[model samples]
Target: MRDLYERAITAGGLHVTEGSKLWEAYREYEMAILTINDGNDEEKAKQVQRVRALFHRQLSVPLADIESTLAAYKSWEAEEGNTRDPDSQVDDVPPNVLSAYKKASEMYNARKQYEDELSVVAESEANKLQVFLKYIKFEKSFGDPARVQVLYERAVSELPVSSDLWMGYTSYLDRTLKVPAILKSVYHRATRNCTWVSDLWVHYLLSLERIRASEDELRHVFELAIQCSFPSMNEYLNIYLTRVDSLRRRMPTGLDFELIRQTFVDAAEFLSPQLGIEELLLLHAYWAKLECNIGKDIAAARGVWENALKKSGSVLEVWQHYISMEIERGHTHEARSLYKRCYSKKFAGSGSEAVCHAWIRFEREHGTLDDYDLAIKRSPLV
Candidate 1:
């Protein structure tokens, strides 16, 4: 009967890790026998062995969330004794306990020796950083949250000026610890130590978003990030995008259109110095689309495209977007006139093929057959 239950459990648990009925029944059966005839010492010892053997066997297999088995094992150890002696022979110990003991002893020895090994070879900055990274990774493998944090703290204490170390430390706190206060605290500490690293501030804002902070809170964070002197235009763009995305999702009432408009303007101003004319053209196009889509401000959208074309009239696609916007607003006549203006530019950068093709498509869609034919015939060769 035990053999039959074991076979079914093995099959059922092959793909299971938690909340398994087979696991519960097995543990309950062992517990029931162990509790009966409590006065018989030899029988009780044998019953205890049967339960211990069950845990050992269960531990040997790849069970997910071993917290249950590990906790049970610890309880059994409290009742019997801890089997964590390094020099003790494995032959006398149960198989599961032996495996756990060997792993624990190995980890203890490595941890005990790590400091001595580091103090000798950490002679240069590069070498010391490498050793610290190895130590941090080693602590992580133990899956002990406290030890991992201690190692991170130790690394940061010695290398607070190192942005890489600070970043790694904060990321561990954010991803592994997943404690909001701890994440926020470390990010604050990290930014103070490495204010020049813009990505840290970006990540801070994102973490706030993840916790579903208020718009006022997000605005405060964005303002704070802007106040940081080390941010580049690209970082500013990211901050703006994050804010816009969060607000877009919520679609809350009393949204501050003016603040968002100012963000777009500020982004263009800050980035104009770094971007070339062609890049600026695309940037304006993107901003125009944002105004159209997010703000539904058609006048503002038209203003952006007009400004872009006035500065970059030579580009074909910018003109296409401008005319498309007009057409989209039901101004087919205006779109046709804009197409004529585009052809008249005859700018050296103009690829006449795309212009003529677009013109033909526009006329065919919005004008009569006569208008379309006129477009194909009157358009110049590339």
Candidate 2:
């Protein structure tokens, strides 16, 4: 029976209050034991100590009926002849115990204010979220881990689809607790509840990587994330980026180089059709850079850029970025050839003018005086 009560009170999320029905029942059980051991002095003394201990435990917690419980404790002490003066009952308690009770009572009162506000905002999710956030802040600063967790559970239960609440809870677990199983559990639930949130998926992937989860597990999560309907194409892009980054970090020996390259290729193929020209070009640029830096395959990088140019060759941005990549890689001859190709293409509005200016600047920086003079002569403005 005692074990049952202990388990209930200390359960992962149970919040037992002082002077509640459970406390009352526990105290009555102890009193009944005292009655049963009336004739045996040793047994009676043990029961008496048990009752005293129960009272002390009850008094330590703050509850609405705490004063009544204290009064009852004092009366019991007086009847047992443990107190010299019934009127000085407060004096019978130790200074630290009394101080602890007082502090608990004050904290309870402060917490009640937040609870009241929460009750009033029950119909408004936005307001309720605010209240929960404030309440969580209070608990984090003044309460124990269990209390904070209980509050988070409550908040998420009421706002199951709220990405903000899920993010906060998962972040707290990741940052403060660092318990892998618990973090994994919470993250799993968070992603399930907030499936549309790419950030949550990204964080989940990162968390799994942090704990060294198996590759199959990480791939399962990544697949689940890509299947969700995120609000923006960039969200999809971010998820792909996080997956690639995880693979890179996990395999420093370049064992996963082909897999990483395949992921970029997959991202480009999957995202290109859904993205605007600018976004498509951005994706290609990222893929090309990855090929150059990590795969050490400049030809493959150029292939990625060539694919982008096929899709958006008229977009000056694509040509400019391709030229810039070549320049950055010290492929000066390739950059000059790209500039010549760009100038040969017929551009609308000031696109041709922009290319002319870029070519002149490039010649000045990387070409001889003859090349610079020739570029100046070829400029339409000149």
Candidate 3:
């Protein structure tokens, strides 16, 4: 996970100033180990020595929480007073604990910080979220999952409509904290607050699928996701397709190909006015390929292609693919007729060159001299 984060931060063009979040987190992880207590004196002493040395090693360079960490180190030495020879090795712990040292470092400061931030949130309406964000990250840095959960809950209560905060909170629980019950409750609430966002719905459904929710629960999310408020049919179609893609890839055993086909048909029908004839035709075309590739329903695939072309016959790629399917099935007569329809359409879309080339190639390989001449003569370019 550390390697993954390093790569992500480096790839993201994070400056030293921007990377304080990660440095703070790393420092917090090491600090948590300072509190562990073992039975054997030798092993216990060895462990404390190592952790203390670690603090010193990191002190050579600056960290995001250098003052807080140094203060904690000082408090630790004061607590370990007179146990070993004073002159044996490293310097003694400093005078005051960093923010009350261990107690302050662990949880005491978090409550104080939260209260402080809440007071500010109530006062500042405009750019006030940065305060709550600071509190949440501090809670997360300390390694108490329950404390983290409470902090997130309090955060979203004040800012119900912010998608980024909700996503970050839910993601922390889902991935870092690993509390399913908390995650589910939060997702349910977040969707209610953020009804108009498509990607939020996608992420919510993806979480459901990741946890392998019941088919009924999954369907419930899917139903809600399709109704999300996108500006256009094109955007709505993209969200609808994201749900279908999850079913195809993630839940294959329960994958009902018929349900998938019906979904495409209904989506096209439901939004056809905004989609227009061209977009609707394209949906049917993709559905045909899905049938051929995944459902292995060649007969239904061919049926979709033929039906779509009859209603909307002008797209060049669709015509080309239809011709290939017919010839692949040894129906040269059918292929020849489809090619004739392509010529009849006179290359209506922007892909005339590719379609004409495909026609010429088909005729040279499968057509008579007369057929070859017909293809060249009817070319739109000519």
Which structure among the candidates has the greatest TM-score? Answer: 2
Candidate 3 lDDT by residue in tens digits, 198-282: 6677777778877777768877888987777766677677666766777677536766777778877777667655766666766
Candidate 2: residue 124 Cα off by (Å) = 4.3
| Residue pairs in collision within model 3 | 71-98, 74-94
Off by over 4 Å in 2: 1-95, 143-145, 253-255, 369-378
Each prediction's number of clashing residue pairs: 0, 0, 2
lDDT of 3: 0.66
Per-residue alpha-carbon lDDT of model 1 for 1-382, expressed as tens digits? 5787687664454222232467657877877877775689999888788887776666544344444565666666556665554233443356656586455445545664556556776667677778888877887886867667756666677778788888788777777777777777788788888877888877877877776767787788777777777645666666666666666566566676666677768767776677665566656766777788878888899898777777677877678778878888888888888878786566555566677878898998899988888788878863
Candidate order by lDDT, decreasing, is 2, 1, 3
TM-score of each: 0.64, 0.81, 0.62
**Considering lDDT, which of the candidate structures 1 and 2 is the better prediction for this target?**
2
In candidate 3, position 205 carries an lDDT of: 75
Give the range where candidate 1 is weakest over 10 consecutive residues by summed lDDT.
Answer: 10-19
Q: Write the per-residue lDDT of candidate 2 for residues 1-382, one digit (tens) a residue.
A: 8787665545431232322567777788889878777578888898899888877776777555667777888888899988777776486876776776687677667677877888799899999999999989988996477777777888898999999999999888777777788888999999998889999999999989888888889999999999999999989999998998888777774456888889888998899878887677767887788888888999999998898888888888899899999999999899988988888677778899999999999999999898889789888879
